[model samples]
Target: MADVNPFYLGAFAVYLLIVLGIGVWGYTKTSDVMDFWAFGQEMGPWLATWSFVANFVSAVSVIGFIGAVYGEGYTLMTHTIFGLMLGTSGLYFAVDRVRNLDLLTFPDIIASVTGYEVARPIAGAVLLGNGWLYLVMQLVGASLLVTAITGVPYEYMVWVIGIVFIVYTVLGGLVSVAWTDFLQGTVMVGAVLLALGYMIFDFGGFTAINQQFAALDSAYVHPTGEGAYTAIGIIATIVAFFGTIFTEQNNIVRIAATRDVRTAKLHLAASGVILSIFYSALVILGGATTVALTTSGLAVDNVDSAFPVLITDYVPTGVGIIIILAVMSAILSTTDTRLHSTGITTARDIYSYFRPDSSDDSQLRVSRIATIAFGITATAAAVNPPGTIIELYNFRAVLLTSAFLIPVYLGLYWAGLSARAILASIVTGATLGVGTEIAGGLFGVPSTFIGVGAATLVLIVGHFLLSDTEPKGGTMAGD
Candidate 1:
């Protein structure tokens, strides 16, 4: 390992203090389970908007995504950026309805719409599983970036970052997560813009950077790039991203926290626009990193190291520090949100299902405990990740979208969906999705399509078969 830079360590320490301070303030404001999970349904447009962006974009975008572009070319843009935009568009129609549900957790919405108390725990289980994978991905990406820049061992960085975020999240829940996310989101965008400008200046222009990147490998200029990403794989990835609005608990919680339907819609629209611009900058920076590394004859151990290596070795100290903070912000923002969501799922949906008469204080205590437990577990897993950051993200997304997309959205709008059918959809979709992923896709088809397709089929057939047996007077929002 290289010698650690005092300046970088100092900057990271200051950032942590600032976030922890915010967490303490948030704790002062949080008094009940509602405040912990949904900020008492009082978030305004700007806070909700940036929090949504920070939670969604993550270290995957800053570290793993830049690395993907450096290695795979522009094809990843289609899989991630375009897919994210498509997913955000779907949220435009969903926010108003979801916000109107007046629910604390995503699984609560599931139970409300299906009129089945048992549906809550079933959906909560899927949320916990997906949230765990996503939390691990964020920690892995953060640790990789920190290790590359600070010369710290990956395992130590994982524990440090994990413990810090978990403490803050447990202290204040969504209140802390949202406030800190706002700060992190601002830092992330500013740092990205700064880095992008510096890279463009160094390369002379965008076209020059592209020319140099293409010269290194002509395949880098192609839409599909040099990766194993086939057209079908790209499409499947896009669909998975598009379905995130329907299934992601973090996003759903943000929508639910907004003060009104208008605020929720505004938040989604603003976040989508900001993310589009942010991701576009990242793509350019990716190409620029390719040019810089090739010209310097420097090679990275993996694609995920591309951004960190560029900022640390190639860029100036001040700019590098700021970019490092941005990467940290991306990691912390997402990790906190995921941690909080996972905790809420554990307490509100899963635990409450088993003990329906639990008091609000009891649930709140359980939520904090669950957050700490999952945080420690995820930190341990990050020490030895199962796969690359993007790969883990895609796997979680496919499983989540497949299992929850049809049931959550349809249950919200279609009153005819029986609780039994909804439960079956979750099980079938999650099982097939995980199975297909383990098998490396079903004979060339991506797991997203296979799982979602199977889930949809199961939901429709099960509903029709059991509609008469189950009484259906659920309070579906659309109904």
Candidate 2:
């Protein structure tokens, strides 16, 4: 029996209309580079929260989270809770300082904190490297999702998502992504929760799902029954939350876009709590559904399809449309932000780094072009998609978190932290991060956790080793 109905098709049309309308409206207001890039730094708390939280919870959680719980179990959830707790709390100190700095990008913050000489090229490379790969991941996820849901050619979906992202980002910049996120994020959150409730009721009750989980159970109280609960596996669970809140350019940019420090603080604090609940609910729903399917003797290839497959195969017509909306909302919010962010990094961080005297307007134009080039590159990566969202995400998060997390953490608090320490923090963390990821496959060790541990070690040792040196410049973001 074919699962889809015309209702979804109609809903999709409505979604497209709303997206197009928002893009056009945002474009009309974009008059300069800052207007297109940072919403002219006029965002309030609510809008900033959406930009932060929605992008934080995207296709990766939609697919990878459930698959992780199903594979790793309660252990992963424990680690996730730890990481999120750290990230959400750490944001209080870190983000307020960032807000005070009057900077637009992470690169800007770094340059001010460490002196422009060391900060310029390294920050640019970090932002561009981080933004480009992350963009590719989201783009790939979008391509895979559209094709799976619609049975359309993956290329068509890629072009559609890429073009739409490039168009509005070039036109409206952060203003476009931020405003659009509020709408899409709301729809996505509501739809996901609604679907969870409906699915539980449809299955007869929690008892049914529990019985299935019991059968599949290992020692892990898995939020579903996955084996992800090992010592290091825990750290890997929600590393992205920590990684992005500090180092991710999009969040930094969004925070920078706020009108003042108070607004930035309000939005990020609110976003962290809201996003934590949202993420927990999503993983729970995924685990429960997988248990149900396994109980019924059905096998699913990728966890990304957990919600989508259930909607198409199990849910009623009306209910399914809601789920599709949720999925589309998540996809759109992430892609739009990524497209804009990658462009910002390329133009602001890399290209302009080489040419300091370039006009802002000229830089903005170059950013848009880079956006398109990166879009195509990302499309290629996502078309095939590397692995489940959680796994690929964990790999990226571990590497990124190790490399940047310490610098942000120390930079915000430890006032006497030397310039040499800051450099060591980045260098050591990055070196260990790569080594961990590469070693996992051959050595049969968990790379994600291994990398995090190694990075942590290097960060600590490197800092002490450089304790004697004077910071090359005055520290702090606004200095």
Candidate 3:
């Protein structure tokens, strides 16, 4: 069993109090729903970029990601690299486009560009489904870490984190979440760097870590190897990258929330560098765990759990306090923001389209309900904790690929991207994504690619067939 120390308890308590305090402070003066959802368009570069990267690299990477590499080797990192790069590039394409539209949600992006009333609601549903699935993954990931550090039951941690997040979110809205993320994100980044540094020295420095990696003949670290990467893994990564950036609401909402096209682009530039570094560290840390563990002969099956297990096993109680803080920071930073995203996505994009007369108060109420509902759903899914972190991570990428990839690009870039064309593309992609998942178990090849592959076809075919509208416009948000 895991022992919960006093220093760890005190550290987590202080972190929680500060977070709650900021949320309450922000809530006291929120002007409206826009303020609730987008911090009233008030985020600066530092706040916006930090919030983006923090939310981007959460519990999934910290716990789940490391676990994934431990099981699958460095090949997992390849998919992530491609997905990350493509995802960022995809965002860069849209930041300027969305910024100019000044949209509240991704649905706003769909409706503004597509000129279809129906696309707004459908897009919202697509976003909500994808966002909530990924959000639950984050929630479960956080809860597991909390339980390990605090000796609380996973379920209790889930509800505790869930309720606390809801309080500040419902109270301060985006104002509270963004400001709090900045503070929490800082803690998480600092702690991870510190932990990694300690790890480097503990192994007698980078020379030893590298020599161990090289001796092991781990092809996963060789970023240049192509064939060592499996066909399916690369496919999984490509589909995830193609679909997620455009489809997922969290990334898009951040983009849309920006003040202008230029701001959104800068946000992307900042996020690309920060997010890549953070994710790569997880891979390196995962590799290092083998050097430490294999020599010791511990029966470790899961890599994601490696970080937690390391703290308890090798690290002293005092130093473990920092790891505990990192875990808690990861849990709180990701979970609260996710609760905020799902509730808002469902309310603003999905619910409002169906219920235009819905008041801001009613919307706020619905947002809270959605948050609770998502938290409950995640708790249920987490009970099983199937496959690995990498498997779960791929789910979002899968959904994003089928539904959003081509439609997003065509919708944003090509003037011929009609609402009908986009809707068709979404249906086709979704069907293929579902098929890929089903086929993978039996045949060992993913069905998800069918949707993305066909959608790209649709993107090409749709352009010529949909031809020549006089100029609804060639508008974009910024650079």
The C-alpha stretches of model 1 lying farther than 4 A from their native spots are 226-228, 475-479
Over 4 Å off in model 3, which ranges? 220-228, 441-445, 458-479
Ranking by TM-score: 1, 3, 2
Candidate order by lDDT, decreasing, is 1, 3, 2
| Global fold similarity of model 3 (TM-score) | 0.90
Count of steric clashes across candidates, in order: 0, 13, 10
TM-score of every model versus the real structure: 0.96, 0.89, 0.90
CA error at residue 198 for candidate 3, angstroms: 0.7
Badly placed stretches (over 4 Å) of model 2 are: 1-4, 218-220, 223-228, 236-241, 441-471, 474-479
lDDT of 2 by residue, 1-479 (tens): 15335666667767877787888888888889998888888988888887777777676666556665655554555666557657767877767778888888777776666664446557667666666667666666666655666666777777777766767666677777888898888888888889788867866776665565666775436442354345544545467446655777887888888999899888878877887777767766765777766766665776555555666666677887887788778877887787788788878876677777889988988878887787777766766666656656666676667677767566656665656566666766666676767566325555544555665666567667776755555533322
lDDT of 1 by residue, 1-479 (tens): 55788888788889989999999999999988899999999999989988998887787888888888888887778787788899898879877777887787788788787878777888889889989998998998888877877788888999998989999999999999999999999989988998899999888989999898888888888877755678888898888888876788888788888899999999888888898899999898888988898789787878887888887788888989989888899989999999999898999888877887889999999999999999999999989999998888788888888998887788878867777888899899999988998889988899999999999999999999988897776643322
The lDDT per prediction is 0.86, 0.70, 0.70
Best by lDDT: 1
* Per-residue lDDT of model 3, residues 331-391, tens digit only: 6666777678888878887777778788998888788788778767766676666555556
